[model samples]
Target chain A: MANGIIEKVKEQATSVWEKVHGSQVAESILRPGSPFKKGYSDTPRNRSYVIMNNVLYHLHPVKVKRHGVRLSYTLCLGGISFFLFILLTITGIFLMFYYAPTAEAAYSDVAALSTSVAFGSLVRNMHRWGAHFMVLSVFLHMSRVFYHGAYKPPREFNWVVGVILLLLTLLLSFTGYLLPWDQLALWAVTVGTNMAGFVPVFGGQVKFLLLGSVEVTADTILRWYVLHVLFFPFIIVIFMAVHFWRVRKDGGISGPL
Target chain B: MSDIPEHLLRRSAEAKAKALGIPVEDVLAEMTGEAAPTPMDIGEQPKVETVVAPDPATPAAVPVAEPETPSQEPTPPAPVMAASSADAGDVDYDAAATKAGMPASLLKRSVEAKAKASGASPASVLAEMLGEEVPAAPPAASAPPPAEPAPVEEITESVAEVVEIPIVEPAAAASVAAEPPAASRSGGATAVAARPLAQPEAVPEGVRTQRLLTVVKANAIQQVKSEPTDKVNTWPHLMIMEFAALLAVTAVLIVLSVILQAPLLESANFNATPNPSKAPWYFLGLQELLSYFDPQIAGVTVPTIIGLVGFMAIPYVDRNPSTKPSDRKFAIFMYTFFMMGAATLTIFGVLFRGPGFNFTYPWADGIFFDDLKDWVNF
Candidate 1:
């Protein structure tokens, strides 16, 4: 049986080599000692080619106006806001490892995370501050765009997309505010959602939908924890993709008008 | 600016007025003054060429001079020749500008200056260069007197300097040479160009075109003293800038988070509602508003309207084409007022509102920090 297995493996290796060597060009490039460099030539044309070939880099225009990236003009507020979102996502995931969404365990889990888990406090701190900073930066970005009149003309639709994003940011922050299952989180969310309850026809229903009950219960904690860590983040990602894509389509960050 | 047309100025004024339910002339008067400045100019290309180029005889055909001149003294003869050539061929300003390695807005302005220097109506010159019929006579009043023409000696000196330098790359000259007649044909018919006396009859159109192309090329070389719109590539410049900003933001956030722990009070107890339950800082504005009006109005109706009208409807309603803040005085005033009110209300909610959500100064008991400590120390 061992001899037969060895022969079969040798046959497979031979076939693979035959396939590889059948194409002379592939054989030359894929050979163990081949001198081929993976990157394109360093010419300006090839530099553009590199951008076009890459998936991530292609989102950026090969050339951008200097004003679009000016520190004073944009303050890179949008970029910083996005970076904070990424930081929150990472830290939030780390927090989840030590967290329990259930009301019976949620607050205790947080206590345990802070007391037992290494770097737990640091991660949590980063996430909290990142959330607040994201909100602040997004607000400032909107103001920047408005003051610069960057929302005019072709960028009008992008501005609306941006507004939706602003709403998303607030929603994300609000939902996450309740995850700690502490008095501040609980009362703050209750008061904040109560505002939503003031909606004309669907106020009570909306509140019920959000809290998963009439008040902040185990279900409410679980639902908010899920929304904060997963659902809202997922939705925000979708909206963010559309937002970034639309910004590019609307001629990259609006400059002047 | 050669880039912002007078018609646009008028249209923006009209739109603002109509939106505000005021007279168009009033809007015009309000927007026309200090709002027009080159300081922090956005450099949008003139839309006038598209609108006015199509009909040569239209009253809008009056070719205005360049609005902002380069701070650096430009070579007089170069732009004069460039403008004349641009007019002669109905040069596709956008394409030619690209070929000359300058932005279209700046090129348009430069061309206008050139036209003004040559004592020609830019549109008519373009029409003539394209071999189109010129308007019978542009009323003398239409032509503004030349603001300042470089002295003949200075102009010649500059012309000599330009010719000797050969500053423009050969590739750019070749590209410029190729674009003219094709672009000129589409430039719209208006008038024939009065041939420059310096033109040699023996020279072919292509050769003359080459010389004119050189003029534009030279202007671009000279204009390099001015800031360029797209100076650096986005990859390194934008990406690096964004990364640096992220690092800075992270550093600030780290310090803040480390210095002040986020508040996490005792596990939620519905039976023990805090005396003045408050929302997050962002919602403080709405919460403050709730004190003034019914919850339905402050929380629901007003926010919804502001969202729909202030953000969504702004582009459609405001419609003032000028992006400058000075020009957008009324819009700015409204925005400022709304922002200030929201900020004031938020401050009141976050700081001043005390026990039982009653209005109280932050320092009602003592110093502001002592009161703040009472809340935090709890």
Candidate 2:
């Protein structure tokens, strides 16, 4: 009786799977060369189509030099940096749900994540570490490109764009460092901004503009929050788009050397 | 025919007359049939003499001369006649057939049928069929006997028809030969005699005689700037490795997150400042520089001028084209030196500096950095 019941359940599950996968909706969603698309066979033509027909084609060409694919050649540092940015964004959004950008709530809200919220501390930890990793990866990626002399000739402008991206990543990481509104966040930002106040003539104005006042306050938290979550992200994304495009246009990742 | 502008027709007639080495009036008169065909000697015309193959076995080789004069209208019978003279032994028939996308047997059969009908060798016919220039004929005197007069008349007729027709479809021309119009039965009969004995079945629409517009040598048109490099598809090759990297990074991040809790200290108390307040780890290197120099030089000038602008200028300033490590020793050395210096400064700021920002060993001072407070206990 149990065996018959199990067989019936198995048959029903198979039918449901077939119904969903074979539906027109599913077919429409899975593009022509998508691996998940029904009846997708591995062929040379299909391999080309897989990139050509997908959005990833925007970032990567249909083919790259064989050496470009090797792990040691690039160390995949650039790709890892991009992936870390995405991971941070995901974890950042989750943290935002429980966070408030006010001095009164920010510290307690962060502390509560470790005690009350489910996976909140874990996600927060990921966001923090991921941001650090992104900074490290972007720096390493720049170093790798320099070591390959990939910045020469047509790639010179792309290297400039890369430097700008690195600056933006640092700014994003620095701004987020203050969101917790703790003693560490407060003093760390104070020391950092004190240096900004040392800028020659317009130092005072720059410091005021950055802190949203003479010093870090509730207003500074809100300002940094918006910059961290929205403004910098928007600017960085545009730069990343141009960077990825120029990589392909400048004839892809530099050399075997 | 009346719809064609007179000057355009006259210009075309002039071009044809020049090609055929005859008067424009003669060509115009021949087109209107207002006079008898010009009795031009075939031997005097270089084009005609060049096409007159000495090998009697390749009688159909005559039409191979038509494609030489760019101004002349394409003769519908040329491909047929050319296919018939496929006896040119130099061409690899199997390779040509494969390139042309047809079975070798089918190509051979077509060549044989055309050859039998026109009394031409199959080798020369195949060569012409493959769009290769037929080897220059010996002379007009040694030209094949059977099709000698036929080529001259065919040339004049094709030249006369040039101004009236913009394009001639081969299938339509074949049909015209099969059922000649009442007015042109003699010309149609000559075409029919030269036609291939067995027409290829179901010839795809794209398979038509290609006309050469110009002959720009490969070097003149294509500038090969770079050598073809070894390449692999991004899908399974690059993408698979990329996926592995992504997964590996994610696993590491998750494991790190599980083990290490990100620090959150007491709420901000502006009145009671923490001693030795330091910036984020990334900025610690700059702060370390602050201890050695004026704040303006270390903080503002160094970060802006030397750090950001200087790094951006590396490629432009270096001017060294070679990427080889051995060749770029100076560039590599400077970068490595800068990296090591910054790393040392950052480490000193993070671990050595204690209360009142004074230098102190982390082991002796019980570690002042709050971010790492949880990881290291006194």
Could you say which candidate leads in TM-score? Answer: 2
Q: What's each prediction's TM-score?
A: 0.58, 0.69
User: Best candidate, DockQ-wise?
Assistant: 2
Overall lDDT per candidate, in order of appearance: 0.64, 0.77
DockQ of each: 0.38, 0.60
Candidate 2 residue-wise lDDT, B1-378, digit = tens: 455557767877898799778889998887566877774433213223111223333344543444233222222223333444344455466876886678999998887886676555676556545542222322221212233324545454443211122114643442222221222222231221222222323345565422211112334345657655678899999999999999999999999999888988889889879998989999999999999999999999999998999999988999988989999999999999999999999999999999888999877777778878877852
Docking class of 1: acceptable
Error of 2 at A230 (Å): 0.9
Badly placed stretches (over 4 Å) of model 2 are A1-20, B1-224
Lowest-lDDT window of 10 residues in candidate 2 chain A?
Answer: A30-39
What TM-score does prediction 1 earn?
0.58
